[model samples]
Target: MTEYVALLRGVNVGGVTVRSADLKALFAESGFADARTYLASGNVRFSADGEGRALKTDLERALAERFGYDAWIVLVTLAEMRAALDAFPFDASDEARQPYVVFCADPAVREELLASAEPSDEDPIAPGPGVVYWTPPKGSSVDTAFAKQLAKPRWKAVTTTRNLRTVAKICA
Candidate 1:
C-alpha cells in the first residue's frame, strides 16, 4: 500500500462544491485506506496499489460515478512528492514569492506554451521527472499577457498547481 497524493481539478471551487468529508467517505468506500483530505481544493492523500496513473484513473472514475461529474485526478507517489519538493527553485521561506509546481500529464514538455512566455531572470526548474517550477515576476502574474495565454492551455493539459508550502505539507 504505497502512499499517493491525488489532486482533483474543478471540484468544490466557485460554489460548485463537494464536502471534503463526503469525498473522504467515497474514497473509503472504494477500498482506499487511510483516506484523508487536505485544504479543500480537492487534495486527497491515500494508500493504494500499482502505478500512479492507474490509481489516478480509478480515483477519477470512482468520484465521477459517485458525484456525477468529471474529476480530473493527478496522482503523485511518495517519491515523486519528495522529488517535487526538492525541485522547487525558489526559497520556500520567501512568502512574497509564489512558488508553483505545475504537474504535467504528458511525458513531452509542451514547447509551444513554454515558448509563449516572456523570458525572465528567474529560471523555471524541473526538479522531478515530470514537474515544472516557476516563480512569476512580481506583479507580473496578474497583469501579464502571459497569464491569459497560459491559463487556457494549462487547463487543457490537465495540469494542477500547488504552492511550495502546500507541496511540502503534502509530502511531509
Candidate 2:
C-alpha cells in the first residue's frame, strides 16, 4: 500500500466540525489502512493501494456524503510531501513561524498560479510542481499581496494552503 497525506480544506471551521477521530474512522471504514489524523485542521495520513486522484475523489465523495458539504481534498504521496518540505524555498531566518505551502490540484493550475504570483522581496514566493512556498515578511502586520490574491474566489477553488510545520508533522 502506498502512504498518502490528505489535506481537507475549509473543514473544522465556520461551524463545520469534523473531528480527527471521525475522519480517521471514515478513512479506515473506506478500506484505508493505518489511517491517522495529524491535527484538527483536517490533515490525515493513511495508506491505500490506489492512484492519488482516484483515492482523493473517493475520500471527498465520502466526506460529502457524511457531512452534506462540498469539501475540497488534496492528496499527495508521502514521498512527495517530504520532498516538498525539504525543498522549502527560503532560508531558516527568512521563514516565518507559519510558512505556507499552497497545494494546487494539477500541474496546469500550479503553473497558472505561479505565473501570476507577484511576491515582494520581503515575502518571496517560490513555485514547484504541484506546490508553492510562501513566506510572510517578518514583523509585517499588513497582509501580503500573495495572500490577497489567493483569497480571491478564482484562486480559492483550485488550491489549499498549510503551514510548513503542519506538513512536517503530518509527514512525521
Candidate 3:
C-alpha cells in the first residue's frame, strides 16, 4: 500500500471549518488505513492500495455525502511529495524571499497555468512536474504582485499552495 497525502483545498477558511479528528474519522470510515490528519489545513495522510485519482474521487464523494460540500482533494504519494520538496528551485540560504510550491491538481493543466503566469523580477517562478516553485519578495515592504497573480481565479481554482516550511513538515 502506498502512503498518500490528500490535501484538501478551501477548508477552514472563509467560515468553513472542520475538526481534524472528524476528518481522520471520515477517512477511516471511508476504508483508508492509518488515517491521520496534520494541522488544521485539511491535510490527511493515509495508506491505501489504489490510484491517486480514484482515491481522490472516493474521498470527494464521501465528503460531499457526509459534509454536504464538495472539495477538491489533491493526492500525492509519499515519494512524490518528497520529490516535490527536493525539487525546490531556490537555494536554501536565499532569505530575500520565501519559497512556496503551488501543487497542480491536474497535470494536464500544469503547462497551461504556468504559461498564463507572468513572473516579474520581484518573483522568479519555476515550473516543475505537477508543481510550480516560486518566491515572492520577503517582508511587508515589497509589493505582492506575483502572489496576487496566483490568487487570481485562473490559478486559484486549479492549484493549491504550501510554503517551503509546510512542505518540509509534510515530507518529514
Model 1, runs deviating above 4 Å: 109-116, 122-128, 137-142
Clashing pairs in 1: none
Ranked by TM-score from best down, the candidates are 2, 3, 1
* lDDT (Cα atoms) of all candidates against the true structure: 0.71, 0.83, 0.80
Error of 2 at 132 (Å): 0.4
Best first by lDDT, ranked: 2, 3, 1
Best by TM-score: 2
Tens digits of per-residue lDDT for model 2 on 31-146?
99999898799998888998987898898999989877887888888888898888997774544534778988888988888888787776688886579988876554237788
Q: Which tens-of-lDDT digit does each residue in 1-172 have in candidate 1?
A: 8988887877876555878999999988888889888887888888987777677788888888888886787677767778878866677666556677776664454344455556455544333456767666556555544455557745543667777678878787
Model 2 backbone overlap count: 0
| lDDT assessment of candidate 3 | 0.80
Model 3: residues >4 Å from true position, as ranges?
A: 139-143
* Clash pairs for candidate 2: none
lDDT of 2: 0.83
- lDDT, model 3, position 64: 70
Best candidate, lDDT: 2
Write the residue-wise lDDT of candidate 3 on 108-149 in tens digits.
767876787777677788887688888876773235665776
